[model samples]
Target: MKSFDIVTLTVNPSVDKSTHFSGLIAEQKIRCKDPLFDAGGGGINVSKAIERLGGSSLAVFTSGGPVGEMLKELVTKEKIDYEVIETETGTRENFIAVDDNTNSQYRFGFDGDVLTDSEVEKLLETISNLKPKFLVASGSLNEGLSSDFYQKVAEIAKTSNSKLIVDTSGQALKKVLETGAYLIKPNVGELAKLVGVERLEIDEVNEAAKKIIADGRAEIVVVSLGPQGAVLVTKNEYEFVPAPNVAKKSTVGAGDSMVGGMVWALSQNRSLKEVIRWGVACGSAATMNEGTQLFKFEDANRLFEWLKNK
Candidate 1:
């Protein structure tokens, strides 16, 4: 059997620093108050959310330098188990700015340094050993890595008898779908790109999602529609799960939170529809918080109750 419940893989993790400003101005002194920093990157966000929901998962990735050190400190504080491959380049940092008045947020992201072949190989070797029940790989691939990076990880998960859940966009997601991933969670925009067309209505979006399911590329496909809710497409069924109406806070890490919730529900042997219910609850919960604060068990439980009534 499975040694661990979940294992998260992030190729490019970062230290996310968020601050707030009253307004925005170009070429002007825009000083904000104190900033908040947290361990980031999609997979890390997922692992953190899982921990908050009273579940534990391992976080595996590569890091180095001062920022990486900060990441390790926060991970230690969270009591997360992680296996990091040391690299020459430091971990990257992402900045987010929120305007208290308009409630609009602006984000700036830096490109993490490229990873050497040996560094990538080290991560693969680690995956070979753990063989957790669920392999959750999220976030963007760093520079100098081919689209086949996720595909290669999927192959590793397959050989290890682990279910692979991918949360990525563009070619990285497309390539993995072609390789038949166990599950894929993509937002509306990512779904449109995968369908090879743009400008889709609900029906069109449903059709596009079915194409991937029909191809047998992925057994489960989750398409998240911002306010319209989400759709889950499986081999034999396609269902739409409505979202709870909520207001306020930032939307960062919502997708990752959804993936985390889905994996947790699956570990509990919940049905696919129940998994989607928890996924929506977690996604909605994450949006109710500011900065990198993801979905906690309390919020997730509250949202689950709201989902039952709705």
Candidate 2:
């Protein structure tokens, strides 16, 4: 297999199905438009977002059963290269429906099949073999998968000299901090939880993230503040880029897009300032589309230009 500068890992991927409905009512059949199925999950969507920006990444994920097979087909259709690990159980599917009347989006998610111990080992082995320059481990873990899973990945990255980018929450994230990573994208709320705080004011976000940096838990911590924007903090430097306002159609793949943009930028040797802006640019651009459609390159480029001046 050819080596890629960037590689993404998704343990609990899903086939995302979305559609629009007239209204939401119980005990009555509400008609909906035809559904649209897309390959999703954190790393998969990150790969898709990278592709949208004319960058390439190899998506590594587990797949099994019929839904897993469909997920493979969807990825192929996207023209993204991928390597799959077969699992004893199938991948899961997620549903998103937009209420046309109120324009509210309701999302329903299902649990993915539990990964066996052997499957987990295979995933790590495959990732170690790849040894990409940038290793992105994103999304939630499957039931029964240990919270230390990302920690194990962190170790492999350290050995391979790969820059690890972790995007997760809770214990898994906590464990990753033990071994440390090259980068972590934690929202403000998650950042507060990491430092054992209930809430954090905007001004306090930098100090909290700096604490993590001071502890050597992460080399660079990017704190995402949703519509408010994001702040990138390192041991010596800090940069905050405000989110650009746009006509948001949906926020389906915004976070993943941000990761994709930042990783792609890093791989291209972009400065930290441009990296965060590209992240915000791609993220905000993703909201300009409806339901898991990521972002168009033109939209992202325009947004990036507009952000460069900010």
Candidate 3:
């Protein structure tokens, strides 16, 4: 097997089908346009985003049945290198429909099938064996899988000396913090919940992130403020970058794109400031396209240049 500098793990991968329709009505047949099929899920999408920026990473994900086959085919079409841990149940599919009348996109997501105990063990073994420079575990856990799934991954990363970057929510997110990761990107609301607060405002992001860092949960905590931008907090450094506005299309893979950019930059030994700029740049650029199409290289470069001065 070829060695990879970066590796992404997607416990639950998905086949993303997107299309446009004139309107949304109750119990009526809605005329729709031709569908676009893409490989999706957090880690896979992050790999796609890295590819868009002329970077490469190994994408490791679960596969089963026809949907899993299709997802693999789609990822192959993107020219992404991948490793699949075959399972008994089929991979999930997500539907994204655009209401042309209202210019709104409606996303319907399905829960992935449960993974057997043996399958889970195989997954852990696979990750433990591949000691990449950066290990990214993203997306939600499969049905019947414990929230500590990512926490276990964190432990494997530690043993391998791989810097783990986690992007998840709820119990899964909370569990990983207990094990300690290299970095975590939680939006304002998620951060608030992690710190046991009702809510958090812009001014409170730094202190909240610092609290997590102080607790040894993570070395770096990135608080995403959506349109307002993002803030990066480390043990002794803090950086804030305001988001650059652009014509919006879809936000399907924006967060994944951000993680992709930051990880890629880190692998290249770029400065932390540059890391956040690339993250915001790629994330903002991803909004220019529809569906799970991450971002274009040209757009990301342009945005990065603009952010360099801002």
lDDT of 2 by residue, 24-69 (tens): 9999998999999999999999999889888899999999999999
Q: Which ten-residue region of model 1 has the weakest summed lDDT?
A: 301-310
TM-score per candidate: 0.95, 0.99, 0.99
Per-residue alpha-carbon lDDT of candidate 3 for residues 94-196, written as tens digits (9 for 90 to 100): 9998898888989999999999999999999999999999999999898889989999999999999999999999999999999999999999999999999
Cα deviation of 128, candidate 3, in Å: 0.5
- TM-score of candidate 3 against the unseen true structure: 0.99
Q: lDDT of each structure?
A: 0.86, 0.94, 0.94
lDDT of 1 by residue, 115-221 (tens): 98899899889888988889998999888888889988888988998999999888888888777788898877788888777866777777787888888888888
Alpha-carbon shift of residue 35 in model 3 (angstroms): 0.2
TM-score of 2: 0.99
Give candidates' CA RMSD values in order. 1.7, 0.7, 0.7
Candidate 1 deviant stretches above 4 angstroms = none
Clashing residue pairs in candidate 1 (N, C-alpha, C atoms within 3 angstroms): none
Query: Against the true structure, candidate 3 has what lDDT?
Result: 0.94
Full-model lDDT, candidate 2: 0.94
